[model samples]
Target: MNYSRRHLLQGSLAAGGSLAAFGDQHLAEELERKLRGRRPLGIVFCVSDGMSQGVLSMSEAFSQQVRSQGTVWWNLMSSQKAVMGLMDTASSSSLVTDSAAASSAWSGGQRIPNGKINVDEQGREIESLGETLEKSHLRLGLVSSATITHATPAAFAATVPNRGQEESIAEQYLNRVDVLLGGGSRFFDPKVRKDHQNLFEIFEKQNYQVIRTRNELLHSKSEKLLGTFSPGYLPYELDRKHDEELMKKIPSLAEMTEAALSRFLSSGDPFLMQMEGARIDHAAHQNDIGAILHEQLAFDDAVAKVLTLTAHREDILVILTSDHGNANPGLNGTGSSYRETNRSFSKVAEITRSTENFLSQCQQELRHSKLDLAEFFTSTYGFAPSANELDALMERLSGREVVEWSQQHKNSVGLLGQIVGNVTGVGWTGICHTADPTQLTSTGPGANQFAGLIRNDSVRDRLLRLLPI
Candidate 1:
């Protein structure tokens, strides 16, 4: 239970080392004793899809500044209640792993190529954790801020050659998954799917209560539930909080976690639930610092809710991790150091929308007549750049410079990220996924199994070892 960073790093260097080799026999015995009880054991995996160490640090700092308390994840580390480790997130094909392969590593315990979901290079489908657990009579659930059919969630529930086969993924959810919550109504709607199959109707006929709004999800009492709040991915946490319609329609990540937990608890059967803050990856991909901070914080809130639910229960195991690092963001040092960095980041609270959404709105508004770029930035982002900054942005908008810059950066989103970074001290390395090792924290039963450094696929190995076969 008491592990120093040096000890963890030393253990990490030994590729063949495992939880038993770590010499935590007492903890393992304790977990075994707890598992021997009559109540079935439950497992929950919480993933912030693209969070890095820098992202965790910044989000914890921002949470403390705004709420006078550190995030639940940081508090867990500070309290040493969670066993922490590093996970190398690489696919068989590349060092940098996409969400599909990253999650597949955890789901199938295999090193598949990037862009695959629980499917190996041989074109064979591997049994995902969800399918395996469901076969063991364990209730299964998948929740995400992104669509349920998105790569992260789909990697757990469905096995496909490509992550893009979302329609097939949605169909797979019908009998396999007990609880499914998130967006991607388009994949299920007859109007949007190329095959024109009404998956929702099929789900309804299967006795699943399909809910589309926040209120419906909250009131649903069905044993099998499907909630889709958006046609595509849900809005960013910052945008959802600022928009009245979104606040009403879309459930927060914590809300979805709570709902999923409610259903799983009601079943009285052992369960495996994977909850993902999928938009953390999207925001990081866009290099939107404010969006990333809020999304990570939202994920932390869900972690807190799970901790609350599992407070006194030793039968539950909680694993919190990220699939991979995106955009490698950090709070760059400034003249005033900590004070200036805090001051600059405090401005993120004023941001109500993502740069992508704001730009879309701007394009819609500009179709009528000429628009003042300076005023628009001021109103939308809560800070107006100087006249020169406005002129430069305007020139980029007018010429091919935007396209050229995007080739080097992350398109227009990268340009906006640079502007925001100038005001805030946050900086991004690039707009692509990094091969950096991500953090993993685990508590409750089998927590020691996840300690120290391991490959991403080993996470699945440890979880399977903890499950009662």
Candidate 2:
């Protein structure tokens, strides 16, 4: 049904609408044309934020260490069904696009500005692919390592003037989505919300299987699952790999993606699930090689999981792409030096883990009610400090640590010095997005339309045209 048909069906047509009322004839025509000969039961749009070319190459190489066969996504890229494109990730304001515009283009079929969701230049509202597909009577799923409100995932479901409108985005959960997972628990907490809308309670009341712990996530068999694994962004793969505690407590992206597919496939038809590896961008921003490589591997594992489940499904389409490029990650080769690093790195990945593994146990002691700051620090970061260090940390942390450190100049200097001491010179250009052409690869039926170096908007335009909701 078109806009007018929808309104007329509800017996309340809005003013200034030009669409004609829905007719059974038109409905039959749509079905015959799109759904008759073809059987695209579902689509999964997976986007990695700010993945540079070097990032992709290195990630594949990194995964090769795990299986020696290399990254599944890269191998799938060579298939005939796959289409290649250079996504011009420019937003309305710059050559480089932020997560909002880059993702909105894919989610809404319209190019928007940086930091805006489904809004146009004139501040008008636009329905995202998530909302559109929801209206089509299809189950909707959004999975990301970041909070669901983080720009890319929000681009398809929430319409807001600013990308930072996370609290309101959490309210959209009441739309009764089939499956939703990721971080950003602060937005759902009643005490954290200024408007007194405790979304966690709302979700619980809605009978959604709300899961906050890894064990809960592992055991959940509910029809609908809402998992917020962290208060903020989940730890990078580097952190998770290094930290044994985190690895066991928090499931990998692969597990989350596979769980979503299982829940979606149980619904008897194809569903829309978009999976994002959010922390890859954060790792790039921090210029942490260990973090970047591990996170990309996590994303690759998720991609591999999807392919394993959907590879034989003629009705399932998978579009994998990145929003923009960050830090232009590259391995400065000294001939075999790069190769040597990978060999050593693979061994290191097995032995070393993320810092978060050790920190999770510390969270209970660090909770607001307990408030043992010094002990918390001592246990988490391995810095059993004197009174002077404790005093400084108090001054820096203020009363509550709802917000994490920004990794800024002086802070970065001190923190890095304390944790992995005595570093200098290297710093993030800015805590912002960078402009660069991204990569897009698609597979499954009608995936040919996504080929041959297209624009970012073409990703959506093709999908909408090929499968207009």
Candidate 3:
């Protein structure tokens, strides 16, 4: 990084002590001086769902250890090209918010109750940012590492009473979103839907080019595209990198972002696009440090791709943030020694699969030899437990015991998480969402409006103000 960039980041980090320390008057002065009378022709909002600041730090350390450079998100911070802020992610019903309500704040300019998407508690549907952009004749696209109809992306394009009504959300995307990419093939297939309606056929009837693999997505020429590479959520990045078949079938978050940008920009019309790294939340909920680290890295790479496309262009506005925090994971001192925490993350690269995937494989091997289970863990994670630890894990893996243990240990994915944490020194507070303020960063036109402390709903209002309509 350049000298000025380094100086700016150091100053920002010092000023960003905590959300409580950020005063409103300072923020008002900064916005007044920097954001007045600015307009952008297009907007790209990128979300790393459930990303806490601790996750970003862990990912940066891991990236520097393995890749010899920090992640692009940190690079943007160190380059002083991004404006940073903190967003309070609370729903109308509670201080802690789920993905649906958290993202609805950004999509609808208000915080609805948890589990509803762009629908108020009074049973009225609010206009989403996607609808507002479409009214101005700007193209809109939604991409995710999760199912396309999942809560985070669905909030932007669909209005539903409950997030579980994914089939209905899938139908709404047909006419509303120009570029819809990600998984959830089951929701669109006739055989899987309760009504037996083939949503993909309906999309094709309306002139959408459906893509099902990485190669197809790269080569498609359609202006309107619907790509589903997995039946459910895509595989974790660590697993995808290790598996040849998955790498061929599944598109990375960065690849989907690039493809959406290609199709949207081709129209030469002002566009609004939202891309999500939905699996980072999933990994955090599981307390799988390796999975979350790789997912964050993938999300960071996608952010880099967006910055590259909008480089030196004042007409485009890019916003990067997260819905809320999950698990509140962080690196903890093993023995009162905070130094060399990076060394613990270096072993994370040896972890080729998620805790859930590895445990499932071990369950399948129970039909054969129990020794196979121990060997698998030892070889894959480079950690062999003591006799007592192996005995406890074996008890959990037995017939009826396994089900009860799984229910109680959902966050750890059974004993796998504890075993992994014992090796990596990463820790988690719980398996659910926390009421932590998420970080927000912005650049390009109207970026200054996002500096300092802001509410989650303010993101929607600022972007809406920039629309041509």
Output the number of the TM-score-best candidate.
1
lDDT agreement with native, every candidate? 0.83, 0.69, 0.82
Candidate 3 weakest lDDT stretch, 10 residues: 4-13
Backbone clashes, each candidate? 0, 10, 0
Mark the 10 consecutive residues where model 1 has the least summed lDDT. Answer: 2-11
Q: Any residue pairs clashing in model 2, and if so which?
A: 50-324, 96-435, 239-354, 241-353, 241-354, 242-353, 242-354, 243-353, 243-354, 246-357
As for TM-score, the candidate ahead, 1 or 2, is 1
Q: Write the per-residue lDDT of candidate 2 for residues 162-229, one digit (tens) a residue.
A: 99999988887566367888888888888887787878878877878888878888899887888988
Overall local distance difference test of candidate 2: 0.69
Error of 2 at 102 (Å): 1.2
lDDT string for model 1 (1-469, tens) is 3322223323333323455534566654444444344223778999999898899998888998888889999889877678888888999899999999999998898899999899899888888987887777777899998989999999887989989999999999887898899999999999999999999999999999999999999899898998999999999988888889999999999999999987776566788899999998899888898789999999999999999988877788898989999989998865654667767878877787887687777676667666677888988778988776666666655544643334547356777788888888788888889999999888887677677888998776566655664
In candidate 3, stretches whose alpha carbon ends up further than 4 angstroms from where it belongs are 1-37, 367-371, 399-414
Mark the 10 consecutive residues where model 2 has the least summed lDDT.
9-18
Please tell me which model should have the higher lDDT, number 1 or number 3: 1
Q: Give Cα distance to truth, residue 432, candidate 1, Å.
A: 1.0
* C-alpha RMSD values across all candidates: 5.3, 8.9, 7.3
